[model samples]
Target: MSSFKPSMSEPKSPGSYCGVPAQRSSQWGPEMVLVKLEDCSHPLELNVIVKEEEEERGIKEEEEEERAFTEEQRAVTEEAEQRAFTEEQRAVTEEAKERAFTEEQRTFKEEAEERAFTEEQRAFTEEQRAFTEEQRAVTEEQRAFKEEAEERAFTAEQRAFTEEQRAFTEEAEERAFTEEQRAFTEEQRAFTEEAEERAFTEEAEERAFTEEQRAVTEEAEERAFTAEQRAFTEEQRAVTEEAEERAFTAEQRAFTEEQRAFTEEAEERAFSEEQRAFTEEQIAFTEEQRAFTEEAEERAFTAEQRAFIEEAEERAFTEEQRAFTEEQRAVTEEAEERAFTEEQRAFTEEAEERAFTEEQRAFTEEQRAFTEEAEERAFTEEQRAFTEEQRAFTEEQRAFTEEAEERAFTEEQRAVTEEAEERAFTAEQRAFTEEQRAFTEEAEERAFTEEQRAFTEEQRAFTEEAEERAFTAEQRAFTEEQRAFTAEL
Candidate 1:
């Protein structure tokens, strides 16, 4: 029998085998077998006959025995592999358990250390509290001691001030007494000198009065002499008047003779013998008038001598009488002067005694006034000193109080500053905590973004590989179709 092989490039219809067209026939069963035949005279006759059932049954029995052997070998290999995987899994689980136990031990050690640190901080705080209490006690004791010392000092100063004030008052009183004594002595000396001057003036006035009385006596005597001289002068004036009348009568006679002579001479010029007679008559008249004047002068001189003798006699009489009167008046005046002298002596004695008594009284009054004024001055000085001391004490107390207030203010300010510093520290710690939280959140966001980007890149690479494989499969299908079409052509 001969076999035929189909060509790779043979064109076949759909659902056909080896270039043969398939048909449905009753003579060919569903299990039809393909046969190869040589060329023959009759188109349907076969040269070889074969039993299909017996050959197919032998081939099926051999294939079943080989498949059973292969299944047994595969089962042995699977069992071995499963045993190795179970052993490796047990080792990995044991390593993981050891690492978990180590982490738990380390956490417990950290917790123990934190507890120890907390206990040490609590002990330190307690020690600080005890120390603060001790310091406060010491400060309170110092304040009490200082106050007691200040009180002692103030008392000592007050005692010393009192003693000083007493000394000053005693000194002032002594000085005032000395001044009053000096003033009294000066007043007494001035009064004594004034009394002496007044006594001298009185003596001088008495001497002047005596001299005036003597002058009055002399004036009375001179007036009596003057009256007698006036009577003698009146008698001399009467004698002189009688002499003048006689001389006037003689001069009238001489003038009549001279007139007759002059008339005869005028007639004689007419007659020569009458002219010689007229010359003789003129000479005779002149001689007669000269004799009459001489006689009158002699009678007047005799009358003047007679009047002087009588007047002198009267004056002598008057002088004797005036002297006698003057002598009598002098005796009377002497008696009056003695009596006046006695009265003046009595008046001077009385005035001197009254003046002395008045001066003494005035001195006593002045001394009393001085004593009163001194006492008042002393009292005023004492009041002023007391007021000054009180003011000084008040000022010292005010200064001390101000100092204490300043110290208290300084302490309060220190406490306030410490509190502010603590607040600043707490704020700094809060800011640090917020910054740490922000950093942690930003790191987690960055990790998430990086993971998403990696996943997207892996997905893109897988999609590109799938598309390339599909394109290669389509190209292979196209090449096979082209070969078949060429063979058919």
Candidate 2:
């Protein structure tokens, strides 16, 4: 033998070296070959020979493997480049799909954003249109309210002014009526005065005529009484003279009888018996004559006493007539004095009535003056009130117009808030109108109540006065009746 040559060491494949050794290893490929080793633990390494067939086979197999790997890689480059090349392929494909999905998501998000933006724009436009419509409606309502208020104010002012004018005219007419009443009363007073004066004059004339007639009758009675006294005195004087003449004749007859008796006695002796008897008869005749003379003287003295007593009675009667005449004169004078006194009393009463009338007239004049002044003041006050009311009405109208203009301006300036502003204005106007209406009603009620109270008081006073007048008239009638009955008694 050839000298023992050293064998070339072969690669060993890994096996269980302690238990058993590997016999052989199958050929895997050029990348991995199977081999068994003698002292190697098992098959530690795989060895391959580079023969044509084997190489061809290996190459083919390698090519086939490569081809398969390339296909897998394509399915995974399509799948992952078959693992490495397949893994590279798979990574590339996954990256491309991710990029495509991201692009789709981005496109979808953009479309959605566009749709939302369009919807928001439409809603905003609708809200703006609604706000504009509400503002217009409020403005129209405010305008209508202001116009109606102005019309109401105009009507109230017109009515109040007409009432004031009518009241003023009525007061003026009342003043004229009072003046006419005063004139009529004055005329009545003058007529009464004239009638009283005429009555007084007639009474005075009648008294004067009665006095003249009484004086004439008194003179006649006085003359008759004087005539009766004179006649009685004359009759007494005639009886005295006749008795003196008869006494003188009786004295002469006695003297003649004495002389005849003395002559018979001296011549009677130696004459004769027949002569003696004749002398004695003559003596008896003388004695008888003496007795007759005594009787005649006694009768004449009794006649004188009777005639004196008769004359005295006639004088006493004349004195009584004189006293009667004096008493009559006194009564007539007393009656004249009483009549004069009555006239004076009547004149005094008339004066008092005149004074009362004058005082009443003065009071009436003063009242009239005061009433006139009050009326003038009232007229002035009413005029002022009317003017003030007119001015107020004008001011109210102007304010209303201004308010209308302001509302228009506000509507234009704040068209968006016009509805709210108009509501506030309307509420304020309603409150003011209610207050004014209440005030007017209160004033009317107060005025009517005052007028009613005054009318009631006047009626009461008139009734009282009428009752007093009736009572006084009844008393006067009773007194007059009593006086007439007494006079008759």
Deviation (Å) of 219 in candidate 2: 99
Candidate 2 global TM-score: 0.19
Q: Which candidate is the best by lDDT?
A: 2
Over the stretch 247-300, how does candidate 1's per-residue lDDT look in tens digits?
A: 555466457446635743563354345324434543453354345434534543
Question: Per model, how many backbone clashes are there?
Answer: 0, 26
* Residue 283 lDDT (model 1): 43
lDDT of 1: 0.45
Tens digits of lDDT, candidate 2, 1-489: 001112245454433353353343445454333333445443334343323334544654675587567555544542332245445446756865785586577548645754564465356436534643553354345435433543453344334323423433357545653564476457546644754574465356435634643464354335434533543443353345334433555466456436534643542342346335534643453455345434534543454455346435633553563455446445644765576577867677755665575476458546645754565466457545644654564455345534533443333234223323333433343344334445545645755765575567557656755765675466556555644643342
**Cα lDDT computed for each candidate against the true fold:** 0.45, 0.47
Model 1 — TM-score against the truth?
0.22
